[model samples]
Target: MAWKFETSGLDGQCELFGVNIFKYRWRDCRETAAVTDPHYGVEKMFHVYEVEIDGQLRRFAAGEFSNCVWGFYLEQG
Candidate 1:
């Protein structure tokens, strides 16, 4: 089954920072990595996923921030 964007730790809204992430046509999940938050210094765990975007592979982090609060961020090179 193809991975759906709604399950991507992001909401139904695809436009992020004025960019249509879904427009890239994100594909299956490749791998997962564990990471800790650096900004808040709260040491929250995040799951980083490598996925196919626009036919190219890219990384994104997704996890719960607090009680039902979840988010994702495109990994930076």
Candidate 2:
């Protein structure tokens, strides 16, 4: 299977500039748990990315994923 465009080149990013959230089961928690179980997702955290483009500060962040926007930039050296 091929990765969709939304997550493509995610590792090659010159700067990571966004909040990505996903629930991962852990600590013996599973959908089959009969008692109270909690799915752990990386709790919301503030993150910023900075890259020097033309000697200028290029800052990027996801702020809140409420909009679910993925941004990226590419340029020649």
Candidate 3:
């Protein structure tokens, strides 16, 4: 199934790998294995965001692990 992304909210900063990264939330951000077609199945969902590193704003998605939020950067295009 094709993937779809949409911005949900701009929350705040989160620290990862000794640096502060901005947090963004999306409606359909989740683990690849957990997701099916958006119209067909119920899957785990998370928040997506963007961060500025070295003067470049990069996109990311947030997921919860062990009660803490984790950030995963999206590929640049």
Candidate 4:
């Protein structure tokens, strides 16, 4: 299913395994996660986001990370 993410901002950032990682909080403050594992020379990163679907909240993570663009994904349980 497609996701609709609210506005987000960087809450923290760090480096691990020589890769830069970032932490962010969603607008609701109930969903948050970090992004790492750069793709295309750090132009693309990966992250998992929690979404509410069918009156239930779920986590999903399936997408690339862009420097100028922010996308959403659900984490696998």
Candidate 5:
């Protein structure tokens, strides 16, 4: 999927790849260790969260930079 960060509504809310994350019930947000990109060497900190959607538990990783939030809708295989 083409994951792109987009702003939603006038409240300064955000969505990942057009998914309205707030529509689901999320909890258990935990911060993990920072990681550096192997190619660019850019270090980033992430928070892992669990959200129940359609009776399935979905995981999400979110990070912030320049006051903008970016995240991954971690699809389990």
Candidate 6:
């Protein structure tokens, strides 16, 4: 993750009327992983699956749930 900052204002006060956190990194990554059987039991076996994006990868052995996408939609292709 990377970050940058900038200042702006009509009075050039840089604080009288300004902005914060102008931007953030929408990062990406990739790595080798294994596959699991989704029908091995009564529940889906999605224990540790590396997620992909646009036919590409972004993470490996991804098991974190606190940061999982609660919901998603194609705002843009």
Q: Give the C-alpha lDDT of model 6.
A: 0.23
lDDT of 5 at 60: 63
Positional deviation of residue 56's Cα in model 5 after best superposition, in angstroms: 0.6
Which pairs clash in the backbone of model 1?
none
| Candidates 1 and 5, the one with greater lDDT | 5
Which residue pairs clash within candidate 5?
Answer: none
Q: Per-candidate RMSD vs. true structure? A: 7.8, 16.8, 9.2, 11.7, 5.9, 17.5
State the lDDT of candidate 3 residue by residue for 1-77, as single tens digits.
Answer: 32343222223445543455443223443334232223344555445545556666654555543244343434334
lDDT of each residue in 1-77, candidate 1, tens digit only: 11222223244444543455545544446555444443464544455555554456665655665555455555444
Badly placed stretches (over 4 Å) of model 2 are: 1-9, 13-43, 62-77
Summarize candidate 5's per-residue lDDT along 1-77 as a digit string, tens digits. Answer: 22222232322365543457766666756655354433355766556678776677666655554455344434333
Q: What is the C-alpha local distance difference test score of each model?
A: 0.48, 0.28, 0.42, 0.37, 0.51, 0.23
TM-score of each: 0.44, 0.26, 0.38, 0.28, 0.52, 0.16
Residue 16, candidate 5: how far off, in angstroms? 4.9
Better by TM-score, candidate 3 or 1: 1
State the weakest 10-residue window (summed lDDT) of model 5. 1-10
Model 2 lDDT on a 0 to 1 scale: 0.28
Candidate 4: Cα lDDT at 75: 39
True-vs-predicted CA distance for residue 74, candidate 5, Å: 2.8
**Over 4 Å off, model 1:** 1-10, 14-40, 74-77
Off by over 4 Å in 6: 1-46, 64-77
Best by lDDT, which number?
5
For model 6, state the Cα shift of residue 54 in Å: 2.3
Task: Give a tens-digit lDDT track for model 4, residues 22-73.
Answer: 4322224343454333333232233444444345554544343445443444
lDDT of 4 at 74: 36
